[model samples]
Target: MAEVVGPRLYSCCHCRNHVALHDDVISKAFQGRHGRAFLFSHALNIMVGPKEDRQLMTGLHTVADVDCSDCRGVLGWKYERANEETQKYKEGKFILENLNIVKENW
Candidate 1:
């Protein structure tokens, strides 16, 4: 018989709650409020806060903070809308800070 392996995941650093999958990572070259961050196509076990417009390095964007549902720790933000056409690709995507997430199932 063969053993089963689960998907690689990223979890909240403070609570170890599964947040995003490694396979969902879109880009590792992103900047967060604290430091380096990763762009993910999807995230789990997270709650999106109220949307607000903020000025980021890329441009003005409407974003919402993403929090860990279990611990309510701020993980990152989700891009709700992008003002720049060149940055439109970020809309509907999520950013998970490297400082706030840990690798799991690897």
Candidate 2:
């Protein structure tokens, strides 16, 4: 089990209601890995990233994005591919957009 750290401000993208931050972890990606990584939550909240940072697919945000309660800040993420958590995410639904905004990032 992990600590929720503390209550944070988050406007639910689903409900648009400010929610509390719980089980949020720092996320990022690793080099030379095959798949993406993410700082997952046991609460089943799908967190991606701002379109701006989405360009970077090798750093933490490259793998995933963890927003604050208000979508104002990135609180946590995973930056590697062999994160050991991919299997867990596979059971659910995770989508990575290949806009090819600039290519070479992914």
Candidate 3:
């Protein structure tokens, strides 16, 4: 069983929000996902996606291929459509910890 440690520090530049998850919620979510019977996980796919893009000019945009989960629009991955192993890893981390979901759109 992996220990549920709080995030040391997480800040969303776009949203300007930094907070941690409640221990109770973290514990519950962890237990529900941590098991040998079945496992699912979410990962930082810094590849091509809808979120990763920037306007270079009026009619131009740019996107890069890097492992930076926060590279412009490199949001996280979805578990259901993803493979089994990926889903398993998704269990270990919280959604908020992985991406900026509830933060402001800075």
Candidate 4:
């Protein structure tokens, strides 16, 4: 019989709390505060902090910090609103730093 397999996931590096599913990944070419980041369609086990406008490489956008609910460690930010029409597609997306997350069940 074929072995059972579970959904692939990304976990918080600090506390091993599952944060995102591999299927939810939108893009992996995003830039984060530290370095490489990934844009995810959805995130789990996280908390969204206060929203504020910040100027990013693409343009000005309102975003909220995302933290791990279990460890309270800052994972990245979520785009609340995009100022430019071309960047509007990024709104409501979550960016998680590569350094802050580890792959699980790969």
Candidate 5:
């Protein structure tokens, strides 16, 4: 479980719609998406759009762009699965950023 720091919430930047709870945050330093760093967590509350096939060194992978359920702003990508069994660990993983965090009243 992530450190519960009191009333902190996560939401979409554009629409401010609730995305996930603060404790759901897995890592804020996950490196992904065009070699840039982002947040990593389990299946988020965001809506997953159409999936696009991507070719990887390991094998073919499928990823869907996740967006805010309300405003439809692009937040991050969801790693659906890869053709290789060794890459199964990335299945159903989300990569977002700290910007998506909605700070609550302290």
Candidate 6:
């Protein structure tokens, strides 16, 4: 069994860019754009670009792909806009499960 450490630190596997703390991880598995899977987090240090409009199960959402700041690898995406209700929580949120996370002893 895995032990529960304080706060797990995460970094981009490619460029070793600091991503977020495990405490911010909201979902371990999430289905994203084009049926892609991802790890959801409340906060992430990523670059979002090429905004696009997408229809989600909850509602219409304007999102953009988020990439690693250093390596420019496709990490996940950002929710730029959403319905009035969804926007309150979805906006500015990010996902980075597709990208590799560096596991190290801190």
lDDT value, candidate 5, whole model: 0.67
Q: Each prediction's Cα lDDT score? A: 0.97, 0.33, 0.30, 0.97, 0.67, 0.69
* Candidate 2 TM-score, C-alpha based: 0.25
Clashes of 1: 0
lDDT of 4 by residue, 15-98 (tens): 999999999999999999999999999999999999999999998999999999999999999999999999999989999999
List TM-score per model, in order. 0.95, 0.25, 0.22, 0.95, 0.66, 0.68
**Native-referenced Cα lDDT, model 2:** 0.33
Q: List the residue pairs that clash in candidate 5.
A: 39-96
Model 6 local distance difference test score: 0.69
List clashing residue pairs in candidate 1.
Answer: none
TM-score-better candidate, 2 vs 4: 4
Badly placed stretches (over 4 Å) of model 5 are 1-6, 32-45, 55-60, 84-86, 99-102
- Candidate 1 stretches greater than 4 Å from native: 1-4
How many steric overlaps does candidate 2 have?
Answer: 19
Candidate 3 stretches with Cα past 4 Å from truth are 1-7, 19-82, 85-87, 91-106
In the range 1-106, model 1's lDDT, one tens digit per residue, is 6554899899999999999999999999999999999999999999999999999998899999999999999999999999999999999999999999999877
- What value does the lDDT take at residue 87 in candidate 6? 53
Evaluated against the true structure, the overall lDDT of model 1 is 0.97
Q: How many clashes in each candidate?
A: 0, 19, 11, 0, 1, 1
Tens-place lDDT digits, model 2, residues 48-80: 454332333322233444443444433333332
How many backbone clashes can be found in candidate 4?
A: 0
Show model 4 residue runs off by greater than 4 Å.
1-4
Expressed as tens digits, the lDDT of each residue in 1-106 for candidate 3 is 6664544333333443443323312322322111211111322333334323333222222323222344354222222221244344332333332333222212
Lowest lDDT sum, 10 consecutive residues, model 2, at 97-106
